[model samples]
Target: MNLSDLRQDDLGLGIGLRTVHFGHILENWPDIDWFEILSENFMHTGGRPMYILDQVAERYPIVMHGVSMNIGSKDPLDLEYMQELKVLRNRCKARFVSDHICWTGVDGTNLHDLLPIPYTEEALKVMAEKVKQVQDILEAPLTLENPSTYLEFAHSEMSEPEFLRQLANETGCGFLMDVNNVFVCASNHGFDAKEYLRQVPWDQVLQFHLAGHSTFETHKLDTHDGPVCDEVWELYRLAHELSGGRSTLMEWDADIPDFDAVHGEALKAREYRQSMSSTSSSLEND
Candidate 1:
């Protein structure tokens, strides 16, 4: 859980590791800061997937972003999955490990989605303790992300930002702030995105995620299927300025476009971050 000297860098931008990019990445090997892997994709592998995984690890740093921790679930920890994660982290030499800050399932069931957690002290305590234990067991500091939540609990006691800040303060963990998630949640919950950024513990934020989302008539969902929206771009600007432009990633999962097309989006994220830096310098000199 030692983050005092954790090295942070804005490696420009990187897209989610998809199969389409494997050959080009391995043969041509485009220059990238790193690749973020969906842990479950390679969870049961021994063929081409694992081979490409190792090759990519050799080329660029890989970060593990998972969805099945269920850290906030009422059920007990999944020790088997934890062991598997440790093995994968070692194999990939991931820079860090991360997962959504909510439950995935309960009662030995797999809901296959990132669900919400009540913002109560009890839930906070449950999540923090479990996270601390996970970190200790994994021998690495866990990075919990504020997921895109579609609903709220009636018994919630604190705001989303408060819950995230408390998680860092109470559990000695790091954060992967997803700018797209914040925008979606704010629109759904009707909170101010800029205000949310101001409340975040930026020092504890090690990385940032930028992704595209689709909008429903009622709310914006984190579908990550289309181009990054202009509105989310604005919110990303705020997050970059607030978090000092922490390491950013471009994520597109479903209906993934061509490899070059996805990486093209990542390049766009780097451009946005460059603008944020210039703006910061101007304001400081004033």
Candidate 2:
């Protein structure tokens, strides 16, 4: 699939639409570039949540991100879930739909976590076929995010970025590059975070996810609990330079703060973008 065939838009800076911020969003209609909604939240529901979503959709661009889709699982694809996803996408007119590169469940049971997949040629072939099937179902290009992993498969044949690059090359699916995930995985797995960014297929990256994580004695976690750390922001700056910028979103899912605080954290991306631009201009003048 041609890179240009993937439909993507630079939606500027955005934050995940959490329930805590609904009142502020509707009342003030804040100056956010866009809002990303968890696909499952509004999938089989109505009432206040759906109502607010409708209002938000009318005002701002919406993008659907899902924790399910379990694209790597051995279970057959869930046609019903994908249909609901398609319906919701049309209902809100979301720019595109995204999910993680990890599996969420197996054997009809949901683990309720983003489980890691082995980076191997066989997994790549299976994932590419599944991605193509999903895109066919949605009738739009599907974007997958890199998974933050604590452990690596001993039998794995390639790095995660290489696997993702091959997947996109084969399937025409875009990527939602989560910078925090890169940092977390790098810290836990002992890989160079910047090198991971360099290996990413930036041409297929449709959006970037920035979030905060927790540090533990053994490993770092993708908690999204607070503000982004300095290192992640530095990586994000490099990502913006590499991808020439894309629709960036701040994800704050746990210990959620007030809307203003979350939005404030998100706006930091603009500062980095400006810095990257200035550096590029200076280089050009040399």
Candidate 3:
């Protein structure tokens, strides 16, 4: 994958479009670069949320990130859901559509969570086929985010980054690299976060996600509730150096804060991005 394959613009420094800040967004229209809409939120509704989304989309560039694609599931693909997703994409004029690289549910039940998939070849083939089918329906590259897992499958054949690389190559799909998820999973699963960054297929990465997570005695939960931690910031630094940066977004889904607070947190990613840019320039000059 090359830069030419990613036709979308890199809309820098965004926050998830959450309802807690809807009034602030519409009234103030803060100086953020873009907003990532949870695609499902606007999918089945024609209510006030949709109205506000219309206003926001008109003002700033929009991207669609969904949780319910169920790309790795054994269940049949939901054609009606895909059609509705595309409708929402067109309605908002989203620059691109993204979902997690995990399955949501199986056997006709909506689990409503991003469930992990094993990293075996069979699982990879299933996900790749599903991803291709989805892209064909949406008529665009379907970007997938790496999920933070609490456990690894025993029969796995590869590392997470390698699996993601294969999936991207096989399906011609894009990636939403979540730096914090890498940190969380690395710490929980005992892997080098920097090594994970090194192995990522940066060329396929279309956007980046930075968020905060909660730490338990035994493991970490990907609860995007507060400011990004320092370790994740350093990992973000590594990722920036590798990918040369991409459209980065901050996610704060739990214990939500005010619009300004969340936007300010999102802006923190800029420090690493800018500093990396300067360092790269200095090296080039040397």
> Which candidate has the top score in TM-score?
3
Candidate 1: list runs displaced more than 4 Å: 7-9, 279-286
For lDDT, the strongest prediction is: 2
Which of 1 and 2 is the better model by TM-score?
Answer: 2
Off by over 4 Å in 3: 1-8
lDDT to native, each model? 0.86, 0.91, 0.90
- Give the per-residue lDDT of model 2 (tens digit) for 46-138: 889999999999999999999999999888888999999999999999987999998988899999899999998988888888999998887
TM-score on alpha carbons, each prediction: 0.95, 0.96, 0.97
Clashing pairs in 2: none
Which residue runs does candidate 2 get wrong by more than 4 Å?
A: 1-8, 280-286
Model 2, total clashes? 0
Estimate, for each residue in 58-91, the C-alpha lDDT of model 3 and write its tens digit.
Answer: 9999989999999999887899999999999998
What ordering of candidates by TM-score runs from best to worst?
3, 2, 1
Candidate number with the higher TM-score (1 or 3): 3
